[model samples]
Target: MLGAMSIDLVDLVYRFRKEEKEQHQRIEGVYWVTDLTRCPLKRTYEFKYPELTAKDVFSPVFIMGDLAHRGVESLIKEFFLDAASVEVEGSREVSLPNGRKVIVRGRADAIIDLGDNSKVGVEVKTARADLGIPQQHHIDQVRIYNWLFSLSYSILFYVTPDRVTQFEVRDSVDEEEIIERITSTTYPRYPWECSYCPFSVLCPHKKAHDDRHR
Candidate 1:
């Protein structure tokens, strides 16, 4: 009976130890557009309990996303604006009201020539499945690039294992709102967000799920 109940202890402990250091970083000292959109509580936990919340587990989906991005990025160089045109690091800097420095930057996957003097920014993403066009977080990412470039529009591509979908979003990301969010305190902030957060169990604002559904 004891043997039947036994699980792979080595893998379990490896996973536990591996997760201890993943995504562990200082929050307030720096910021990314994701922190403002992907549940502020996630950022809160990463900052507040960096050790406990880090998850270093291997995710094939994440690996696929990376491979997809790299493949697409290489292809777009020949047809559109080359990789040389984009900045990868947080090279562009924005100064806050309190003299705090924040950098605004992302590796604009590509820039498309509109044939006129104008151009559109591109962001490529790979997801396990199609959530929908303009998924909020990915939108936020591209919108930030648009804001930085002050372009009239941007494109988002979601490549899943099954298919690819594209969306053209207008340059409407609120720079002030983003600034406000980063300055504000971190809480889970939204119940829906908690349902998807890794730190939901430890989150003070995490909503109780209905056991009946389970």
Candidate 2:
């Protein structure tokens, strides 16, 4: 049944052309593996506040310390125009292949702009003593952070209980011997080997070697 209707075929064509003219396509940026890996770490750190769960005995002391720390941070922030803000880029929990879950969160205390065209990541370690880490272990920690966060360099801020010396997190460097040790699938050197390691007494391999030597 063909009825004599004014079929506006040209109007339909004009509408189609208008619809196809200059449309903006939303493009999603591709994220790398390192970007995805940071999510777990971010979640872990943000959720678990160990201090909050702990008893209130240490609360006042912590608050006081934090106050003092923030003051120093304010001064440091003024120095870097590029990295003027201390932002929590990511804080999450990450899982290892061995099924152990670790909170891998890092807050950039203050990023220092090198003035030319560079930046440095600062991590304030406010403590009574220096964070004594096995050389190889320290290198691994720094190296991994450097790679993941795309940091050119980092600073380790160490503060004493007395506040005698305000420890600034500087590029104090890790040695090549530590690098060599990291590459090798072996134990640490003499002095480091003799250090009070938690794994020592329980190490069956170490016990066996000692027995054989005896």
Candidate 3:
């Protein structure tokens, strides 16, 4: 007789997340496209205090979002004839307000070749709610992707519990705007961001929202 085998699901998730992070370790002083979408100070903290800013990669919400992105990428590969690329890496050099130059890099979700030499980028996101289907941060992310990849346009795809939808992002930001976002510490780019930030406890700029004011 054999005893029942038990699987440590938590351990498995942790390993998966660790492997992903290891493969995509951030470079020192290089800003990522995703950074432009979040509180600039958050990035500073992540690099400044690596130990304190370390996150539990095994988080279920984060895992679910990664899984959703993978599923969508698979669907694009299967259905889209012109889906020529996935995880397209791009980088651009921009000078900061202080005249110092830095590299901003990003990996687009996917790229679709129109067969006429034109291509479009894609950015996939998953959320728990459908409200504000096209989030400003997400839009900014895709727009920056377009600029990085030199694509005239890109699609912002969202997967939510209630609905699956996407929006077109044709406008792109200039180098000056990217530099501003990278250097600004205005903090909590979105009102609801602090509530979910892992470093909120250590962040001086964390928004203190009063329920009574709402």
Clashes of each: 1, 11, 0
Clashing pairs in 3: none
Q: Of the pair 2 and 3, which is ahead by TM-score?
A: 3
lDDT for each residue of candidate 1 in 55-137, tens digit (9 for 90 to 100): 43455555456557778777777566442243243335667789888865445667766656676777887765664545666
| Backbone-clash count (model 1) | 1
lDDT of 2 by residue, 1-214 (tens): 5598778865664454344332311112222222222222222222344233233323455555565567768777676654555633543344444554443333456666665755666555454444342233333444444543556676655565654333222233233322332233334232343233334443332322231211
- Candidate lDDT scores, in order, read 0.63, 0.42, 0.81
Model 3 C-alpha lDDT per residue in residues 157-193, reported as the tens digit of each score = 8888899888999999888788888887677887778
Candidates 1 and 2, the one with greater lDDT: 1
Error of 1 at 3 (Å): 43
Q: Pick the candidate with the highest lDDT.
A: 3
When 1 and 2 are scored with TM-score, the better candidate is 1
- In angstroms, the error of model 3 at 145 is 0.6
After superposing all C-alphas onto the true structure, candidate 3 shows an RMSD in angstroms of 3.1
TM-score of 3: 0.87
- C-alpha-based local distance difference test score of model 1: 0.63
